[model samples]
Target: MPKIARINGPRAAFLRRFLPLLLDFDKGDKPTGQVTNEKRKEFYDCTTRALVLCFGYENTLGNDSPGDLWDTTYDEIPAANKMPKLPEPESIERDTVIKALTPVVHTWYKNRRTEANSPAGRAVLTQRQVERTVQAFAPLAPPPKALDVYQREFKQDYIDAFAALWAKKLEAAGTDEDALKVLKRQKGGKERAFAAMRWDQESDLKKKEVVQRCKDVYADVVKRHKSLWGSPHDALPNSRMWSAISFHRRSA
Candidate 1:
């Protein structure tokens, strides 16, 4: 079956900025995992897979509980105040993947810190980095609507898969929400009607650092990958990398 394609605007934006580090190009060796020159297909598979693992395929797919099929929809997720729980790994959790990949993520941040510590990451980030970050997140922001509070059922398998990519990030900087706010210099709105909201502080220096980090990463990715920019369809607005940016107004 063709699984549904559900896009989280903010998360898609996050992945566009950072997940590129995961793309290892070899002139001689063929690319493994998700890699393609056809950007749309590449993004669809990569973004969907990443989301399915992080958010859980079962929650997004599979049969609904009892006769509750009519109630299952994307809007039902936010109200539940659901923090993701990862599932068990099918294979050994190799330290090498973490060891190899973290440096790239850390370096992306470190480069920004070096340039200005004001933001604390590179001048720009890769597409993968940005999208993956957003995709990896379980929604922390309060729902815009009142009925969005109901919780959706999820299986443990998705939780573990999502964790495989997130545990290191959390350990390095507390929670993902905290890290994003600290690193991005952003804040949630004060809506009394929303029960799941959490308060975050934004320091002058931290805000600068967060913006700088994101900016730097964006700049870096552009510098390294020229192919990502091509015909009209290849720019930021239309790319899968931008899918998570809820505020983006580009038509598909």
Candidate 2:
């Protein structure tokens, strides 16, 4: 008699327990070639549960709680003695899973259109339920919009440029009394304090000079930091700059 190889390991042990449950699609007696609404719901529910299990297993090996598995990719399971090789769970990218499952979903929809065109076929999934299904398996949110990305980069660049200019102006003047007074009144919000500096000045000429100097510094900083704000042509609008300055003044 030939001896059979025995599968042994934590992974094998886990699969032995859950794999059958994961594949257990049949609940009871069902009609042949007919995909009912109940069946569709059950299928998605089962898939979601199976994903949770896989996520749990990955989390357990990494000494992390299963609850902490949302939006995170699982690490590759190493091949152990007598265990089968497992692919990294992270291999399932958004496009990859959608590509693989979309065909099946389309086939089901086509079948519904041709064969099961009754009320059962017309049953639509709720938005909440669809959201839940997506949240269960999706590794990350959709990428940010182009405008949002540009705005974020611009905001950071503006902060760095403003900081450098403020430092330089302080060094050149040897005293930042007016700026410091505005800062104290504005409770140390740099943007607000800087804006307040113009209003706090008693002389109209001095105020005009302060505002012009601020505009000049901003223009120079933008020029110096052009690379950080995406393209060289991506300039901050004068209206937005003045509005930002006035907003701080009003807040102060």
Candidate 3:
């Protein structure tokens, strides 16, 4: 059976919002990214780790509990058996919450682009930074613009979307029924449990993992930017700054 990879909660939340935006390249092990290959791996690993941690896996069990996942330090190097998986929302209702927040993800990336290219020494945000910002919007009341629906309504709608999409993907992939059983897990309480588990888990260990993930992702971000825009300009302004200005100018 094909196993789902695991990730930390914040990264999982970010994926719930922006996964639809990623083009299904159907090529490499990792999703395609504008960043460097190493950065892409960092993105994939960090996001998967976030999902796994958030989804209440035994590996991430709370410190107070006998499971005590905190005892095991977070390591970027995967053990032969360790696989980072995102705990997918199981039902239409839960999936709705995931889908409803998609816009927040888009807005985050757009905002990051603006910041990275800012004329001044604005914060050169990395993908990790952007994911953190988007994750902050979870449980937020549905904004009154394009997504002008009640929170309940949005969650339901998101669930429906996720169900439909999962069915299609599973069918296309020719996956086994048992392999997809994980998708059937009840979502509402499970999602909350996953979050609480992280809270009860050791704070120090969690902090260390988060920082390491961020650093790895940051290195990738730098590689990606350099690859895309060529080396930063020798003079005061960098290529990213110039690119940002041009992007805004074109949009304006």
Candidate 4:
């Protein structure tokens, strides 16, 4: 019979801590006696499954031995010693589903916007026309529950993607800086042109004056574009002249 080698220090400590949980060993008693063939097989199977679950199949590198899963070449256990606990399988599945669906939702939004702004679409830009256009492309949208979860989880990623698209549209229309300001008003950033105008720095009277000025500008733009802005199908009315504004406003 092959003699079981004595394991000491960190490897012994690790087995003491984790083996019980992995094998459902009795916690009150320390494992003892010469290791039997049956016990060895149980340990190998349990450890192999644990390693595969924690680091994934790729980490195994085609090795069936659980001991081969860790790189002994390193003085330490690579970064695995500091790695966070594995998330529950259900959480992993939920995250995977959300990641897979986000791009599809984004693509659907882009295509719907494109079709709605087409010349033919613009010719019949009524509420009914817009509803019909959206309904025709309804299949493009992800299921509402999935979309809600994705939007909640990846809000910043969605915003950045849309902002990049909006920036490209502005560039294509040859909009200048002054025209871009109207649309920039709705966007959030620390580096905006009016960022220096903080409420705390201004007197109450000055703040009121500034607010009034913004309202006046917004009113003028709406008045000028009233005819074109009649339906959601229309792009931001005079968007070229208004410049850098996004057509889709996500609700807060």
Candidate 5:
């Protein structure tokens, strides 16, 4: 708060210039200026993701929960009686997956937190022979609304097959044998997300180190083996050393 109060502070001018606009933009009769509503929304999504990653990327890399930090920070705000009160956002927890087998690898930490903290409320049902009286969300249209809440029913045997399938994936986890070649293909697209920036830098450095190591090893072997086999014009390449070179290149 003192830092914010300081007139010469780095962000003081920024806050002063933008704070009123930020507070007022959520009000009625808003002017979006040259930007269209769709463009504003598109930029909002990208900006929100970028800012969130900036705020939480290091904590995420260190295996901490950003959501917990958000809650803790919110609780520490000083209260003023005349301050505008912002109502909490409306949220309705939907039902969890049924008898389907859940993959631990694919499960997101956020969804796990939601599942643990928020229970699905009882859905209002029909009194008679279930003519679908209870559509949980009143604002939602009837059927064909692209149900993200639930999956289409699958046979028990088909769901059971995923166990064996993922078990094969577990066996192939670190090997070059990616099931869909996705891991290998995505390597061409260098990591662009801010969330993985540190990891991406480390990975790139490791690749350069590996390439340098390979070059050094190649040079050392050529110099030493040249002493044994004489000039390349006088002698053919050694079969065993060439085989080893091939093996090392594939491993790299």
Candidate 6:
């Protein structure tokens, strides 16, 4: 074996303890960067970008968890190991995630919609379930009228969408089953664990459905936004109604 290249310092320490364990390699002979084959390497890139986008790795990596991942880091170079910088509002996959979520969010707040023009900044959602979904995405939600605001909201959604896209990608890539297993393991929790278990036992068709429906993204719903989302202007596009899949401008 050609000796594996290594990186040390804070980034090295970070690779060891992050959420998805697959991305958690840097000590062993094959550091997380050089994980055997190209597929896992692809997993590394996808997961890291998603992490930076979702957690704001730029701000969060060393503290409690991911806050905001930056374009650069001091202790350890984040872009090392072939990782790519996360794109912003213009990111197609990220935009797809937010757009897909917008319709559902509107439906959840329809009562509010009918009541008054609630400022997009307020908690807005009353129900616990909806509130939890919105809140659990903390350090990542605020009035998304500006690019900075739009950025915070997109982080978590961007991560989910990346996972959804990667699952399909891995399945299509052939028998590198290990990568899929690692991806599944990262979703640890009673609910997600149960879902992962069921996925393991289900038919291929069912698995596909779980991945698609669960991600809350539907190509059918988002196809409408292709024209607006394709380029990147518009600040989430549309004025009143949800003319797109993710977010439409509201009273700000």
Candidate number achieving the greatest lDDT relative to the actual structure: 3
Give the total clashing residue pairs for model 1: 47
How do all the candidates rank in terms of TM-score, highest first?
Answer: 3, 1, 6, 4, 2, 5
Q: Candidate 5 clashing pairs?
A: none
- Write the residue-wise lDDT of candidate 1 on 178-201 in tens digits: 675553322111121121221123
Question: How would you encode candidate 2's per-residue C-alpha lDDT over 8-114 as one tens digit per residue?
Answer: 24423332332222223334355333664455544433333333333333222332222211322212121122112123342234224433433443343334344
Per residue, candidate 4 scores C-alpha lDDT tens digits across 153-180 of 2233244445555566567647577657
Q: Assess the local accuracy of residue 132 in candidate 4 as a C-alpha lDDT between 0 and 100.
A: 38
Q: Positional deviation of 83 in candidate 3, in angstroms?
A: 2.3
Off by over 4 Å in 1: 1-49, 53-58, 62-200, 224-252
Predicted candidate 3 versus true structure: per-residue lDDT over 1-252, tens digit per residue: 112323324433334443322322224465344544455344344434433333333322121122112112233323313432233533233234333333433344435434545664144334444544343333432212212111111233244444455566567647667655554444334433443444345367654554455455446545443444443364212344445665688999
RMSD of each: 19.3, 25.6, 17.6, 30.4, 30.6, 22.9
User: Which is better, 3 or 5, measured by lDDT?
Assistant: 3
Candidate 2: which stretches are off by over 4 Å? Answer: 1-27, 31-33, 36-92, 95-252
Q: Could you give me the TM-score of model 1 versus the true structure?
A: 0.22
Instruction: After superposing candidate 5 on the true structure, give the runs of residues whose Cα lies further than 4 Å from its correct spot.
Output: 1-39, 51-64, 67-252
Which tens-of-lDDT digit does each residue in 45-129 have in candidate 6? 5434443343333232332343334312222233333233243533455445433333333232334333323565234322322
List pairs with backbone clashes in candidate 2: none
TM-score of 6: 0.20
- Higher-scoring candidate on lDDT, 1 or 3: 3
Runs off by more than 4 Å, candidate 6: 1-84, 87-91, 115-174, 187-252
Q: Considering lDDT, which of the candidate structures 1 and 6 is the better prediction for this target?
A: 6
Please report the candidate that would top TM-score against the real structure.
3
Query: What is the RMSD of candidate 1?
Result: 19.3
- Candidates' lDDT values, in order? 0.34, 0.36, 0.38, 0.37, 0.28, 0.37
Candidate 2 lDDT at 198 equals 28
Instruction: Provide the clash count, candidate 5.
Output: 0
User: Please, what is the TM-score per model?
Assistant: 0.22, 0.17, 0.23, 0.18, 0.16, 0.20
